[model samples]
Target: MAEGGEDPQRLKKIAAAAYDYDNDSRWTDYWSNILIPPHMASHAEVVEHYKRKFYQRYMDPDLVVEPMSSTSSSQSARPSASTTNANEQQARSRSSGSVPRTAGPSATTGAANPSSVRWDQQTIQFSVNAWVFVIAVLAVLPLVPKNLSNRAYRLSFMGTACSSLYSLYALYGRPRAWNMQGMQVYFQSIVGAKDFIYFIYCLTFVTSNLCLKFALIPILCRALEQVAKFLRRNFTRSTIYRKYLEDPCVWVESNTTTLNILSSQAEIAIGFLLIISLLSWQRNFIQTFMYWQLLKLMYQAPVTAGYHQSNWSKIGRTVNPMIQRYAPFLNTPVTAVQRWWFR
Candidate 1:
């Protein structure tokens, strides 16, 4: 073969060798040692290298050498070329319209999933229980005696009063955090603001129901106890109808026992509400404090020195004043009578 004829073969061999060398070195040091630095060195140099490399590898050399008649080739290759081009176009269109696939259900079943469901169920059950408590308290109200001692009345009232206060606290204790002027701010500076607020709401709802339940019931129960005490006093004094009211032991015993049970129920309801409220408040305070700490960290940290503090000062300043105005409502008195009425 002529020297000129062997030129293309020799050039192809040289290109293949260079490609192999670059490809092998690519997995190790070639990218960091050569390509990356060149690209970072100068935009113009990078662009020139990219263009040269792209053309050398991708451009058809045969097109340059054999610039012949379009008519002759078109006649022979028309059908096959058209079919290939159509297939390529269809593949590209299909790929362009294809939607992406995701991972399995496990991806969505994190801590929040079951917790959210449980909360929902609890809320529903509690709502039903609250209504039942209210009905029970009401049913026992008219049976209480008016002449009962102050201590018995007070005990009954304490339960309902606490529930009312707890309900009120839950209703308005914590405001939702507002995201304003690109800053996230809590209404209350305490921890777990959201959870506390939710707990308070639930507790308040339950307590309110309890108050409605016991308000009349306890008063009536006290009255019954007073009647039994009066009957027992007369039974000891009289001799004629002594046998009729003589079972003072049974009447007195049952009345006192029933009163004790009702009073205990009231106490339990109040104590439970108070405990939940405290827990909610504690959780909210911790979460709020933590969020504030995080905000402070973001602001004070050296890494964030250049970060801008947005115009949230105006809104922040109003928060304290708002709390002050609502303080009276928040601190409203909870009387023993009111509490007993609820229980």
Candidate 2:
């Protein structure tokens, strides 16, 4: 103790704190390794300045509003006592270039993540939108006139593709769900969010091109009925997926018994029209297109089955490189461009 029970060591630390505040060189180094919080055990003034400023900029103000009094008609003209005191203190600290020795819990708690919570809400809504879209397409497709069903189906496919792509982009760019990693593994990643049933439903859109044979349409509907059952069982209970699957209007339910016959008939008619368009020369194009669609499905099947992107990449590495070499030339749009030049 130096004098009157004052500790000599604390005086030295207080001096060091002043030294730290004035010296820009040490302060720069202090910030370069900023992740390591300052040694405030000695009541570092330099650290305190920053800590107060941090709260001023980022802290949510704890406003205390008392019940209004009818006697005070000029209430709006005067600020609250707390606010006035806070402002006065803030001004004094700024003028003196010294922060008060207040290291309250609010200063250390940092900021709350309102944006993160909002994004989670957005992700839930996006999933709900996708679910609603597919259901709408299914319910309305049976009623669509045969003459316009082709265009209507194509529009439905395009709409779904856009929605899927948007969801994927949004999901990948930022993480929202606590258990989920990225959209690449969203539906299938058991280690992440096990939402595989939605992935299967998305695939059915791509496969609708193969909607041939009216008699087998009933069987396909039956299989999708099972898909609905599986989705309800596996996904409806989980917190992340329940918002999408179990929501009142968005809940995916179809009368498989009644709908199957109508759905099958629609498919038969669609198949007949498609078959009538297959000219002799177009047979090769049809075959090639089918092969292309199958190839695409092969690439996606593993992902749909729940493997992560890393695993799928490794699994396809052998064949993918070879296919890549010739894919550009064989691709339909590229070939069409080459043909147009000669014609």
Candidate 3:
């Protein structure tokens, strides 16, 4: 009747009655708060216990007198229900040292976790983003000497490319089908994904000869956003994060749109900078061509197209008038590029 002191059948019914999984807001609330740590969410018994409590509060106050009182309850020998509040029971269990706990390494004691840090993809991504931010900052800081700054910039690109690749792999595993049609579908899906675009964006500059400081803006903004998200999710209880990092994290989340727009602007400006470099001896034609292709993909990809299309329109509006007025000869090529862009 009960596996690990919780009745599977009863919990399943309770969860079904309590939750409208199709309701976006309700499901989000249940998953984020009721679920607590993610590991417990997978267990039907734990989920049902919470759902029963949720049902009692909202749907029917007296539908089930004691939800946990089942055949397995007798097997586990838990005492009769003294409270309907699941959270209160958990709190009491913790205080009385009846509840078991599992955690990764302690920040202070350096204790080993049964499931070590390597198993947590979130933590790995967080560390990678944090490093990317630090490296990007070092590259941007005026105090850093030119040689070291250039090296740091290249390292930042390398780190971002690695992080993006890992994220793609973790999100979408390798394709099962390897044939022509199957591979075509898989490639299209990957190309449409936001992570794949970011990977390519970082790869474009990995071996570039130019050290344009403006190029790091997008990498820094993206790293800050990801690092802030990880901190908010995992370090909400930490005193250090609460005192110092919380406000910045909150601000970053609140202004994500602003950050994205800034990154888009920088990217567009960098394209012009590359064109200017073409007039000098430091131009890499291959890098410029590849970067332009990447930008074209960004403009077409659903996830990034909104921001990029708007930026490109603004640039066209401003540049088209100037070209038509003083550079009439460039009008034909500009029209050709516009046609290609729309196509």
Give the winner by TM-score.
3
Whichever of 1 and 3 has more lDDT, that candidate is: 3
Clash pairs, model 3 backbone: none
Model 3 agreement with the true structure over 44-162: per-residue lDDT tens digits: 76566666654543333323535443543333233322222344434423322344343225423322331253348678889999999999999999999998998999999999999
Candidate 3: worst-modelled 10 consecutive residues by lDDT: 75-84
Model 2 TM-score is: 0.28
lDDT of 2 by residue, 95-172 (tens): 323453342356232123333543564455455445544544553467766646555444444444454444343332
The window of 10 residues in a row where model 2 has the poorest summed lDDT is: 56-65
Whole-model lDDT values for every prediction: 0.37, 0.40, 0.72
lDDT of 1 at 264: 36
RMSD of each: 32.9, 20.8, 13.2
| Alpha-carbon RMSD, candidate 1 | 32.9
The weakest ten consecutive residues by lDDT in model 1 span 59-68
Task: Put down candidate 1 lDDT per residue, 42-67, tens digits, no spaces.
Answer: 54444334333322322312112221
Error of 1 at 159 (Å): 16
Among these predictions, the greatest lDDT belongs to 3
